[model samples]
Target chain A: MNESAPNPGDRIPPDELIDALFDGELSPRARREVLGAVRHDARAGADLERTARVLAALRAPPEAPDLTDRILHSADHRRRFVPGRLRRMTKLARAGVVVLALVVMLGVAAGRRAWPEATTLADEQTPLADVNEAFRDDAAAGVGAIRSSVHQVRMSFQAISTADPCVARLEIEAAPPHARMLTAGFVTNPFGIEDERADAPASIRCGAPRIGAGPTIWVGSNPLDPARPAAPDDTP
Target chain B: MLRSEEHKLIREAARGDQEAAASIIRHHQQSLYAYMLRMSGRPDVAEDIVQEAFVRVLTNLDRFDFRYRFSTWLFTIARRLYLNAIAKHRPAYDTDMVGSWKSSAASPEAPVEADEQQEARRDTLQAALLTLPPDQREVVILFHQHDWPIALIARHLDMPEGTVKSHLHRGRKRLRTHIEVAPSSGDALAESLA
Candidate 1:
């Protein structure tokens, strides 16, 4: 047969024909032509023989039973599990949102409850530069006492609610009354004329002393109806 | 009748029918596992893919269309699950099909060896198989290992015959030369995988 002319017995080189053969992708006539070549041509026969050996090695036995079970189980796990998964995901998302909202709410509550702790501009300019430090000291030393010598003695203060000044009249828990020159004032040392006025209770009863010790922390059953009823005063 | 039977069983299983679900499982598991083993070359990984496929099928039986053959639908499900598994754990997969992927991929205990002769042939074939893209690989495994024809592959893949032929052509071309060499020598594997 002529080398260039087509022959029923001549097979195309493998590189040229393998793609068409595997899928029968070639035109029917061309496939017939090529297949004729592959079967009859000695070179093509050699090529196919070599190729079949490779396919043979791939013929490993079926996979293990356990692996087969595992695949089915995995597929089953995916199929059977959806509702529970959706329910779980939804629950987790809701729980997360709830936790986030709760955190925000807690932050707002704390902000409002601790309002008094916010230091005013005047306090910033004054000695109580560290307001939190002062409140902490006050809590530990004693409530409402300005000086308790509880080691590092300190004071704390907030605005006196009313513009008009008021007195603090609580029974002093005197650690030692002998050396106790307890001068209770509003720390208003610049205005010297009313040191004693500042020392007295701004809202005292008619005949109550200027400054004396009594149990300010109300303890008795009728502490309000004191041991003796005092007359009223128009100090307001 | 087969479709209706599978449909009935699937319907029952969706309604929490364990026996029916297991019946579905028992029917398709082996074939699905074998296909995955060839497609992925990791019996253990293929095992996981099969299970995941069935699980998805059962969970979504309500969405299953009865017009198609149940086995066809099952293979589609299996194919999707396998693809998903490939995606989820990407880096470790041997793209070139070297690194003992076929054997190590299974139980991690499948006996492997240094025998250049036996293992070399297997490695050469695997490496060539991996060269084709994933779709081509799917078609090849379904066609050769399972002996499913082009029409069935087309139905399961939802692709046209021409496209399936193209993939198979491309896949076979990629593999044909490598297979021809026999890999009796180590250098052949080195060159093929490389």
Candidate 2:
């Protein structure tokens, strides 16, 4: 027996060769050779029988109880309503988040109103030129009342004059019933006014009139001529 | 089931057609149950895995990949569920119990001796299978029982084809030995009793 020559029995492992033969992996010639070898070898033949028996037994289908109704019932319940319910829950969660955000924003806005520092900062940021123009417009419209509530107007006046030499005077007195207020104010020339009057409380007077109170009056001098008294017809 | 027909049923099932889902379940339930039964060695666990696997598959039918066989997907889901179940509760390989369960439902027309022999062979085969490691058992069951080709088993088991052959070879050899030894041992016990 030459060591270099392939012995038919030693060419493959018995188990592998048997599996390959059964799996049809071997060519017809190799299969005939393996089959012949198994027929002659008792152990190989028994291995083949064992493999066949196991395969036969395993291949025999066990009786599987019908599970269609049970599975369908579970799937139906999940498909019909669980996903819809989850979607609804997701929508409700989104709505809740939106409502919560709105509440937070409203709360912050209300909190900003309650904080004097925030109110002052906001008022300081307002252009004095815009405020003067707004006052002039309100005065011209024969409505002394500023568009904003009275408290905001007071803070606006205090913030404006305290930060700049643009002196504005606003006065309010009782008006007819049902009207909130009658406001009269004037912007004075910064160049004509003496520097000392810039600090004078009388030059930038603002009345603390309650909102929605009885109608109040506002009177002011001509902005172009600080010395001229406000005409009686200017009072609304 | 034909692949085209299976795909059609899957499409309809994905759209929540209960009839289509039932068709799919009926086609697959038996083979899947048998696979689970062999893997877990418990009919109850097998039944639970089958029902749960079908429910999960039908519910997630949209996610199924069409390139693979539906049976592959179903078996994969069932295999995972079985692994999880076994992790929670280890299954027992009770030959007497399994034999009785199978034999009780044996074909009424078959002769009693033939049925007994068939039941004994099945019992011995199952007991021998349980003795092998999980990987070898799975490879053997997929190859021999389900008639899956070695390449498909490789893909399913996520291993090289050579490795699958190695497992199959080893598993078959062990099964042969256990099955061969079982009857002789029984014979020796009977001789002693006589």
Candidate 3:
């Protein structure tokens, strides 16, 4: 025996060394020393036996209850436990659908605002033929004929007279593309000849006598001023 | 189960395959249940922890890390749940009732005397384990019971391997003393007879 090796009778093995021996963690030399110490020491032998018994009992498999059905059933009842990827995908799909609906709705609203339906004053008011006939008859019958025969034309002039001048001007300016047809008819200067000039101030003339043979009325051109009877010289 | 096979099942389960989820549960539930049963020493608590752990794992299957073993992740989740359960209600273990369920399911092939002896030993072991500190008890159970390596237990418990080994050594020594002092059922029977 080497003098460097501690004699087993010198002292009992430490609990750590004994545990390491049982755990198979000790080197072969350490194992031999521990076993030699344990053999020489009855207390160490009993301690080893107790540890072996405890470890054996612990290693023995415990009866595991079969809980497969219960766990699966409980999991199902608690929630539709979809996996993360599928759940995220489902959420994305729902959000995509909502976004698509909003986009379509906004697109339709913008399209309606950008391109509206066509509406003309002729469509809403009296037919152009009737107005021309009334104008022609009134011109032939002179100033007295304007009150009786030109009923529609008188009503149109009265409407323009009572209405906001700016609103009436906007209506004329906003007329549909086909409004140029009105100027080509017998009622040649229905609103007044000077009113046709872009630079001319807005005005209305009601029952004013014509400059020559026709019963044309050339009212004054200042819209802000009150409507007055036209002087024959004002016909230009 | 093989690692490759387990990964395949995990993928299927994440895709919402009920059968795959069931297979995963069937493969792991018993060992997990045994672990919790030993840890809590209450059948009902064990059952509850096992069910809750599976529910949590299956619900968040996509978050699982593939590099680690599925069992490691599962046991980690179960350990957390057990700790939470303990914090909420520190159960007083009924040693007599600890393994009573096993008695009914005991194998017919085993001799009656040996089975009773085995049951007695298991009860004594569980009672002794309950006497240890939580960390020591966990190290002991994971090491001796589950046959986990010291390195794995160290990783699982988030401690150093040396600390884990220290706990295991101390836990085993304490368990031995507790078992030696506690009166076995056989001894009680002998005393009654005498």
lDDT by residue (B1-194, candidate 3, tens digit) is: 89999999999777776778889998998788878877887777788899899988988889999999898999999999999877776644434445553543468998888777666656666677788888999999888878888899999999999999899888988877775676564243223223
Candidate 2 lDDT over residue span B92-169, tens digit each: 433343543454456789888767665555566667788789899999889888999989989888999999989988
Candidate 2, pairs of clashing residues: A144-A183, A173-A217, A175-A215, A182-A216, A182-A217, A182-A218, A183-A218, A184-A218, A184-A219
Residue B9 shift from truth in candidate 1, angstroms: 3.8
lDDT (10s digit) by residue, model 1, range B59-103: 777887777667777778787777777788665554533654544
Query: 1 or 3, which is superior by DockQ?
Result: 3
Question: Against the true structure, what is model 2's DockQ?
Answer: 0.37
Q: In candidate 2, what are the lDDT values of residues A11-88, reduced to their tens digit?
A: 433555666776768777777677666766676675676567567667878778899999988877778523445655
TM-score, candidate 2, is 0.58
Ranking 1 against 3 by lDDT, winner: 3
Interface RMSD, all candidates in order, equals 6.9, 6.0, 5.1
Candidate 2 deviant stretches above 4 angstroms: A1-13, A81-236, B91-104, B107-114, B184-194
Model 2 residue B169 CA deviation (Å) reads 0.8
Q: Write the per-residue lDDT of candidate 3 for residues A57-176, one digit (tens) a residue.
A: 666666777777777677777546576677679879999999999999998778777765532123554578889989988777786644443454443345456753333433443443
All models, DockQ values?
0.14, 0.37, 0.35
Q: Model 2, residue A155: displacement in angstroms?
A: 37
TM-score of chain B of 1: 0.71
RMSDs, each prediction?
20.3, 18.4, 17.3
TM-score of each: 0.47, 0.58, 0.57
Cα lDDT for residue B24, model 2? Answer: 95
